[model samples]
Target: MNQSFPKAEKLKSKKHIERLFAEGKSISKFPLRLVYLKTGLPEETRIQAAVSASKRNFKKAVDRNRIKRLLREAYRLNKYRITEETDASYAFMILYLGREIPEYEKIDHKMKQLLALFLEKETGKKI
Candidate 1:
């Protein structure tokens, strides 16, 4: 499977981000929270995602950046499981709600669980 997160798949539009938070539905798995919105995207990609680390939790820019990187990596590896069957496009914002640094293994596992939860709730199908 092609498991790459290209620039086209990153959520960067300010207008879209505003609309998403204003109108999106969210699911949480402890330190991770996923906010999703169903919308029409011009790109051919089925989903576009963005990750955030709370500045309140991690004071330094480096720490927040590292967490965002880890979150993105985990999503890139696991997104294929969700994208395979869905025909409609969506926007996703993954937020890290932890107060401290995290291990990659924990992040990866939580990411899988989070994605499973998203799939279950959105499509009524277990992954």
Candidate 2:
């Protein structure tokens, strides 16, 4: 309802992100790969995510950072849907696997679609 992305909702931790990738279940739908695992926190529902552009595809750190920003923004906007629907806490990492950087609008659309798919996969029901 606020329509603003807040800092409290963000997922930021190098160790946690790594653990999510290490121990989580993964789902891929081209250009987007989602890895998630349940968390032990009682009241706090936290998400840890990252968007990766392979060095083989993008040689510049600036390009990689830009794409990661776009992906993070898209995820930030749609994450409320995930928070609203699920009671179980989770930690997630989303990887970008495309050969080229996509436009922000396209990335945003894909982010929504992927979030829905992930919710459905985890809950066995449409969101």
Candidate 3:
């Protein structure tokens, strides 16, 4: 209900991150790919997310950080699409796969698509 990306919403635990990569289901939407797994965390912390921009593609840290900022902003704004009342919690790692920097509009559109796709898969209910 806060609608803010606080520390609780960030996917930061080492064990969770490792488990997500090892056992998560993945989906790609152009520049963004999401790896997500259901977690044992409580409903209040239902969804925890991490964003990554590949170091190999973005040689400069600034560039990578900028891309990650965009990704996080987009997800922050649109997370409600996938945040329904449910018993399951999810951990998500969003990987940026673009060769070039992307604009906010493009990232926003794709983020919506990604969330919608995730919801569809999760509930077999279309939004």
Candidate 4:
């Protein structure tokens, strides 16, 4: 797996983001919520993703940025779980649900579990 989050795979469209929140399905694991929408994507793109940390929870810009970074890193490393097995393309937003700063280990573990839950729910098969 490339494991690098390239610009091509980053979710940047305002319209798409709105549609995603309106129509997307979600899987939640504490401190993380995976909101995913089934949709057409550019060729060779299985998923385009974005990460967010709520400003209300983390008032400091530094804290929010760090949380977003961790979310993105966790997703970037483990995204192969969704990319390899499924044919349909998706738009994904991984939201940080915690009020406090999170450790990398905790985020990584929850990310793996969350992705596994997503795969099972969408693919109808055990991982």
Candidate 5:
């Protein structure tokens, strides 16, 4: 599979996002929190993802943007772990919950663990 995160893999629909927030299950690994919901979609496009940073934590747009960027990059690099056989597609929103700026290595490490946990939670089977 391609490593790039294309637009088709993005969670942009307002209705879908609202449903995700309303009904999704969440798992947090320190600085990162993932809210995810599963629905029926094509196999090739089984996952749609979004990243968020709270305005209350980071007052400046630049700060929020930076955190989101890092979160997206980490997820992009490690998202392949989510490619298990399943009957439903997943929509995910990753929230950065750090009080201060974090290193990319830290985020990457945590993101890998987070993705594994997500797979386990969603599938009810170990990956």
Candidate 6:
């Protein structure tokens, strides 16, 4: 078990994220929102994660990028749990909906909790 989320496992397209939001089911556990949809792939999954702290909150792109980086790092650490529990292929988009950027530790904690919630909701199993 690698327990690592590689680039190949990441969802990369804006179009794909848009489609997931349009047709997929959504669950929000504050600060983290999960948008997921079934995919045609044979038991393969992909994830895309983002954080927003742009002009809406911070006026600097640097601030936005830093927040996004934290969110991505958090997701990358915990995605293995999701991959192990689900047999159905899925495309997931995780959005951060917070007014302020958080520390890495805080974001990581929330990521794990959110992923666990998503797994429980989707599979009825606690991982």
Q: What's the CA error at residue 117 for candidate 1, in Å?
A: 0.6
Off by over 4 Å in 5: 84-87
Better of 4 and 6 by TM-score: 4
RMSD of 5: 1.4
Tens digits of per-residue lDDT, candidate 1, 6-74, equal 999999999999999999999999899999999897757889999999888899999999999999999
lDDT of 5 by residue, 76-123 (tens): 988877864455789999999988988999999999889888878877
Instruction: Evaluate model 5: give its lDDT.
Output: 0.88
Candidate 3 lDDT for residue 58: 97
RMSD of 4: 0.7
Q: Report how far off residue 111 is in candidate 6 (Å).
A: 0.6
- lDDT preference between candidates 1 and 2, better one: 1
Task: Tell me how far the alpha carbon of residue 32 in candidate 2 is from the true structure, in angstroms, after superposition.
Answer: 1.0
Candidate 6 to native Cα RMSD, angstroms: 2.3
Q: Could you tell me which 10 consecutive residues in candidate 2 have the lowest summed lDDT?
A: 1-10
TM-score of 6: 0.83
Quote the lDDT for 3 in model 6.
62
- Model 4, total clashes: 0
RMSD values, in order shown = 0.9, 2.0, 1.2, 0.7, 1.4, 2.3
User: Candidate 3's residue-wise lDDT over 30-66, tens digit each?
Assistant: 9899999998887678899999999999999999999
Residue 33 of model 5 has an lDDT of 95
True lDDT of residue 42, candidate 1: 71
Expressed as tens digits, the lDDT of each residue in 1-127 for candidate 6 is 5566666677777887778879999887777787888877544444444444446776678877888888777877787887678767788777777778778988888889888988998899986
Q: lDDT score, residue 48, model 3?
A: 95
Question: lDDT per model, in order?
Answer: 0.93, 0.77, 0.90, 0.93, 0.88, 0.75
Q: How many residue-pair clashes does candidate 2 contain? A: 0
